[model samples]
Target: MRWSRHPRCVSLARAELRTALAGWGLLVLEEAAVLVLSELLTNAGQHARVSPGREIETRFRPVGDGVRIEVHDASTVLPEERRPEYDECGGRGLILVDALTDCWGYGERSGPGKMVWAELRAGSG
Candidate 1:
């Protein structure tokens, strides 16, 4: 599913994750799913620089051995994890996502903008 970068979209992603797991015995992964959503949503809002009325898109797909979550935003800039200052109190969200996800990265889209993606192992089931 895709969503606008609007703030409420974060909650919508969470709800979809919950519904997907309903009675599927995948509930245990809810926190991880939510964390992934939070990090990607924050990235979309912070870096997408999408103008008002423009939209950011998200998609979830079943990969070969896992599930892949991707966030597509209007910005072409790829995400990079930079070390923040010791006194910095923010900007570590992607670091956390990297640690939790089996693999994660960003790539430029064919036409315009970029897509950031993360994957969780399926055998984890």
Candidate 2:
């Protein structure tokens, strides 16, 4: 689904993802999936420089024994994993993603944007 580049989009995406995973009988990955989705959507809302008329696109699909989540934005800038200082309040999104997901990466979209994606293996917990 397409989401506005606003902070609320993270919760919206999480709700949709939770519903979808429940419907698919993949609740085993629900928590991790929601967290990863939140990070991806948060990055889109904060970093993507799309026009006012554009929006971030999020997709969820079943892949093998897990689910793949992707967030598409209008910016080509890829996300960087930063080593935040000890007292930092933020900048750990990707770090959490790395620890939670089976794998994660970003790639250029066909047109003018990039797609950041992560996969959560069901029953991995």
Candidate 3:
């Protein structure tokens, strides 16, 4: 799925993820998947240096008893995990993704962008 750089895109992606997982009978992982998707999409919308009309892409695939979620943005910059103070109101997206998913990381895409991905095992909640 592709989304424009808009704030509502996060919730739109989450809703799509829920529908897809439900269709695949993978609702067991829907909550975590949605949360992770939100973070990735939010990052893309906030940070990706794509052109004005460009959009970000997101993919969901099932991989060996787990679901892999990837968000592709038109920026080559990768995300870094930061240790935010207790009073901080942001910067914890990657941290939550790392703790909730089986594994998560970012990679260079074939084109001019980066893909951030995470995997959630079924029933791993």
Q: Candidate 1 lDDT, tens digit per residue, 21-96? A: 5544566666887789788987797778867766777777655555677888878777888778989988888888
- Over 5-87, each residue of candidate 3 has an lDDT whose tens digit, in order, gives 98988898898899888888889898788998998899899889779877899999888777899999889888999999999
- lDDT (10s digit) by residue, model 2, range 1-125: 99998798789889999999998889989988999999989988998887897789999999878899999999978899999999999999999999999899999886779999999987576
- Best model number under TM-score: 2
RMSD of each: 2.4, 1.0, 1.1
Superposed Cα deviation of residue 22, candidate 2 (Å): 0.8
Which should have the higher TM-score, number 1 or number 3? Answer: 3
Q: Assess each prediction's global lDDT (C-alpha) against the native.
A: 0.77, 0.91, 0.89
State TM-scores per candidate.
0.83, 0.95, 0.94
Give stretches of model 1 more than 4 Å off: 23-25, 122-125
Off by over 4 Å in 2: none
What TM-score does candidate 2 reach?
A: 0.95
Q: Could you tell me the lDDT of residue 82 within candidate 1?
A: 73
Candidate 1 displacement at residue 44 in angstroms: 0.6
